[model samples]
Target chain A: MSEKQKKASAYWKENVRYLFILLAIWFAVSYGAGILFKDTLNEIKMGGFELGFWFAQQGSIYVFVILIFAYVRLMNSLDKKYGYDE
Target chain B: MDVQTWTYLLVGITFSIYIGIAIWSRAGSTNDFYVAGGGVSPLANGMATAADWMSAASFISMAGIISFAGYDGSVYLMGWTGGYVLLALLLAPYLRKFGKFTVPDFIGDRYYSKTARIVAVICALIVSFTYVAGQMRGVGVVFSRFLEVDINTGVIIGMVIVLFYAVLGGMKGITYTQVAQYCVLIFAFMVPAIFISIQMTGNPIPQLGMGSRLNDGSGIYLLDKLNGLSTELGFAEYTDGKKSTIDVFMITLALMVGTAGLPHVIVRFFTVKRVRDARKSAGLALLLIAILYTTAPAVSVFARTNMINTVSNKEYTAMPEWFKNWETTGLLAFDDKNGDGKIQYVADPSKNELTVDRDIMVLANPEIANLPAWVIALVAAGGLAAALSTAAGLLLVISASVSHDLIKKVFVPSISEKGELWAARGAATVAVVIAGYFGINPPGFVAAVVALAFGLAAASFFPAIVLGIFYKKMNKEGAIAGMVVGISLMLFYMLKFKFGIFDGGKEAVPGLEKDWWFGISPEGFGSVAMLVNFILSIAIMKFTPPPPENVQEIVEDIRIPSGAGEATGH
Candidate 1:
């Protein structure tokens, strides 16, 4: 196959990798700390907020926001390498 | 200045500023009107999006929800903000890269069916209008209280303010004004919070104050004290969560998916100049919004702690001036049910006033803490800003549906850019008038209705848009069938529960009124509906004809975003 097709295939693989990793984290934090592990997390403390409370209120959101920016950054670089970026 | 006069002057000045910004940033074309000409920087767009997304509901009701729910309230904070991650990661960049003006455009084109487009249009209208109705009601509430007018007059005035800019300015007008509104509402939210924070705990940040030691210098955690106090009065512990574990999880999921599905928020992503910019804006928007979401839990703790300490098991005569003042607005009431002069507020279902509206907690906080009048005024202005900015964004969605989706796409395929532009303005005016009517005579429960809006969006729009990009086999028939079934299920379920339609006797809807489906509230079933939508579309697609090759090309082009490859002739 030509170099272009090979690069496009690589791009597709990378997109799949990033999406799977991010989805895993999304499920883990929101579902994991929020409801699934509430009791276990309650044992911990962050200042006045309990360990579970922190995850419920701020931790999940902070992580989700970070993942989005990271994806964008990663995608932009991938786009350039694939001759897709503007 | 007298506190009353200063409040009048302050609110008036803020209104004028919003108007001025709206006129200055008037959209010049249909594209300009819908997506701000796609030149907005991620940072500004993010702030405006945050301001637009965080409505009166988030600003006013969230803390109250938390205060009562205690640890369980985390569902809201996590669920509400978690959707942004989904939006930014799974949706925003591709949609921005697709470079469409509206959500339906993507669904319609990718699905390769005008039927899909019409289905999307219906979903968008239902979602946006249902959501806008709540914001309009919130605007009326703020206006009636601070402006010293009746609810009817307040709704009329609120309508004019929203129409002034949304009709004339479009998304461009709403965007700039929202930037200003974000500032007003955030400052108002933080100042009082910080003061209360420092007063209660040595910590100045409300987030820190929450977990910090109480003012009595007791080494015990504040959460523990709150738990003890509330349980003593028969309310659920402030620390222990009481809702069914499955239900909380479902509600959180529904809220997250619903947030991701909102068209107005997604439309904001199209305003950015590049795909990467859309990503940056998501982060920045989350940061801006997190400032409030994180602090709100602290507000819940502080307000709950203070109210329990002051009003619970206490005499009415000892109550502060703010109590009587707020009572006039009907936001706070002391029924003294036992007629014992002292008012005892406890979570104990039997003894509590059982009447405290969640919205009142934030508004009454300033007075409860005895903060000065200006801060109170600022809170009023903030409430208005939160309501108005979000109302404008939702209104833009409503207008664009008529002009861009209906008139341009459905009615007149050959409509000129200028004609489409005028049509948008006309649609916006009509939307404003209609929203005003709902605001004046709000239908049923405002919060419940708003939840239905999210369910509709999640069930109908999210599936079509997501499938359009990833599933090349999803034809127009599948898309339309999916949306119709998904939204109808949501509508029927919500209406059945709300009106008791299913019950056989005078009060019907037997199982619905007795129990929510699967213990999930009507508002939260959206996530389930969306899942059903996805399943139905995929299942049916296996038996149906696939979309033509050209539609596959559109999906591939959206995925790659290399260039404006081709324009399929309408």
Candidate 2:
């Protein structure tokens, strides 16, 4: 393979890895804590909130925002590492 | 001033601001028309996307729906917002790098087929129109309730304002006005919420207020009080959900994927200058959207609690003037069954004398809380902003589908730029009138069709676009087959279950729910259809020839985030 193709492939591989990690967290918060394990999590409480219900309504959304910004920070650094930054 | 005068003033001022922005940002070329010349800043695009994504439903109906549905409504809260994560991580950066004017542009180029492009256009139009009709109706609802105007007249006025900006400035005009609209809608949504939050819990922030102790000297958490009240009326606990876990999971997945696939939202990323800007703006858009989303549940808790307290077992004649006003609008009604002069809003359908429409929760919130007339009126203007901004954005997508995707790419490839621009404006004009007609005379199936739009989008575009980018070997045959099969499967399922067309008809729908595939609702069936699309596409690709080498090269190119040029028609 050409040097450029190899570097591109490497960059793409790293990008895919980051996506997997980030999306796992995304899945864990919303589907896991918020839905599937909700009954179990609701056994705990945070102030006025049941732990599971909070994740379903409010907590999951806050985590989603944080996940995106975190993805942005991670992707930016990766772009710079791969010298793909403009 | 009273509510009418305040509404007129605020709505008038906000309309003038939109018109002013439209004139300032009018598109001159097809590129400018499609993507604001691909030069919008991240902050501006972020705000525009927020306004564009948060439609009339988000502004006028979501909180109210959440208020009644309680924990079950998290499907919307999580579904809508989680899609931005998919967009930011999986879709936005790549599509922005492709430098396309529309979603179909990428599908067409990547699949190397006019067939793929046309299929995409049809899907985009169907999804957009289904969604847009709801927005126009929202505009009409807001106008009639606040200004006391006729619903048809309200729709026409909405049509005229949208026609002016969307036809003249296109996406360029829509983006800037949406920024202004975002400011208006968020401010309008937040003010009353903050007020109610303080009144109920002594917390200024609505999100925290929901979890704080009530200020009524009861020292109980607001949610606990709401739960107690709900149970007292034979309703489920406020934080508990009634939807089956499988259905909730599938529905949330469908909405998130469908949201990522929406052409109007996807096109907003094209307006930015870089792939990085696309990523940043997705983050910003979600952050901006999260502001309203997080507060909605708090507003829901407050509104539901206040509603039950005010009217339950209360004498009908003693109700507030706002109740009478809403009654005249036919959104709220009290029949006082058993001839008892008091309203009974119990869980039992037979005993529930007071029938309240969920759509009124947010609109009537300010009046229910006795906020100032100006704050009440501000919601009217805010609803208009949300509706108009989204309508304009969808209109742009519809017009672009007609002019750029169909005319330029398919039928009349030899057309000049100026000629194409005129065609776009003409399409916008026609789309607005059609949308206005639907707004004035909405079909009986309008509400049912809205959820179907998300299912259709998920079944078709999400799979097609994802495969086009991620799997280099995916051919036109696979994509075309997948889109056709996916969309058809979704429609068949939706018709069979949602409309009961394959059964006896709409009346048979309740009985057919027992036979749902794996107990998933029609709204969540998109996930099933999408999975079938993915599987069938791969199977078809294994037999068919792979996409051309150049197409594969384009896939590899979009993977890197550098050198994204201006969004172009070609």
Candidate 3:
């Protein structure tokens, strides 16, 4: 295999690892914390917004939007880094 | 003018505008017929997609669903938008880089199998057509209520208007028309919501108005009051949890995955000129969608709180015109349960009226808040636009799948380009007639059937397409087997309950444990099936041989957007 292709493969491996970690965080906030731990997180409050309530209403959505943008930025950088970019 | 008359006028005008736009923006070329000439900018495509994705479900139904389901309805909110993230990250870019005319083409070429492509085309048709029928039904319902037309007339009128532009403009026309539809629908959604929020919470922003202190300043949240009323009415607590945690999780996962898999939504990605733009557009489209999604729960809370407060012990004589108007549409009917002159709308089991169609709650919300009639009419137009935009998108996919994927590619590869375009128009014309028929006489469980559309998409297509791109070793045999298993399992389960296994018309009710396996509801079980698809496909591919080295090079090329220039139906 060519050196550039090998480098591209290595880049994707690192990228997939990062994606999994970020996805795990995404899942925990929306599916895990906001949902499964709703009652538990209700104990904590944030300026008239309970932690769990905020997560259900706005926190998770905000986090998802941030995650998508972050993935775009990170992926673009990695793409350029490994010569896989357009 | 009275609110009703004004609403009628605005509704009429909006339809004309939509038809006018459809005519002016119609596609003129074969490429325009297919991918809007593949020149749509990321931002424009993003708006078009947001309009396409947020259907009558979002505009008319989502808030009402959230109002009643309370915290549990977050599944719809998260699942629908979250799928876009999955699409942008895992699917959209690669699919765009594949540079295909239709999804079946990708499956056909990547798997290197004719049977697999045919299977994909069938799945796409069923899901797209079934989903489009639901949209048409929604449009018919909206038109019948607003314009005082018969439901059949409403459905037929909608069919003609849609056929007028959908057949003429193709994807190019649909994209621009969808942009206009998005504006109308969003405006329609927000105006009344803003008014209601002000009346209920004295806040201007409906989204914040939901969490704000109520007018009473009782130091209690609005959700608490709604929850109290619901529990008092014999319904589950509005904010308190009701569904099992596992069912909620699975359902949310299914919806999110299903959203990503939907052919109509995925095809929007192809309209953009570059792969990178597809990624950007997905993010922007989500941003636009999040505006309504974030506000919907708030709108539901506002509407429900005011509704219960106003109607809890109110005399029927003093009820407003909004109540009477919706009654004519059969959206709001009150049966005097206790021989009392007053109508009690509490969540109580025996006493409260059981006649509210959730669709009315959002559309009727403006008048419920005593807002002006123009806002109500705007909502009427908005609801139709939402349903029509999605219906148009689905119709395009169905037509393209038949003409581009099945006919031009598979059955008649030697057909001329002009002949293929005519075939596409013909497919669209046929789809419109069928859609109208189903709209008028929808099969039982129309709502539930449409919900299954996402499941089919999730179970069958999502895994194969994503794996085909990301996993180098995933083979044709694995793709076909995974799709067959995923979709079959979901269909078997749905048919068991929906149509009754062998009994034709009768249904047998299963106990809680029997109804759900692994605590997953049918609406959300697609995610589980998808997981099965991914795991088994990988396992099978490990034992079987991978694609040849030349195929590996194609995979590598698809990873880079620039390499897509040479690909045609690739």
| Cα lDDT of model 1 by residue, B180-230, tens digit | 999989998999999999988878988778888887778777888888888
**By DockQ, highest first, what's the ranking?**
2, 1, 3
Correct interface contacts retained, every candidate? 0.78, 0.95, 0.39
User: Per-prediction TM-score, please?
Assistant: 0.95, 0.99, 0.96
Reference-based lDDT, residue B217, model 3:
68
Question: Can you rank all candidates by lDDT, best first?
Answer: 2, 3, 1
Interface RMSD of each: 1.8, 0.6, 2.0
DockQ of 1: 0.70
TM-score quality measure for candidate 3: 0.96
Candidate 3 shows a clash count of 4
Q: Which stretches of candidate 2 lie over 4 Å from their true place?
A: none
Q: List the DockQ of the predictions in order.
A: 0.70, 0.93, 0.54
lDDT of prediction 3: 0.83
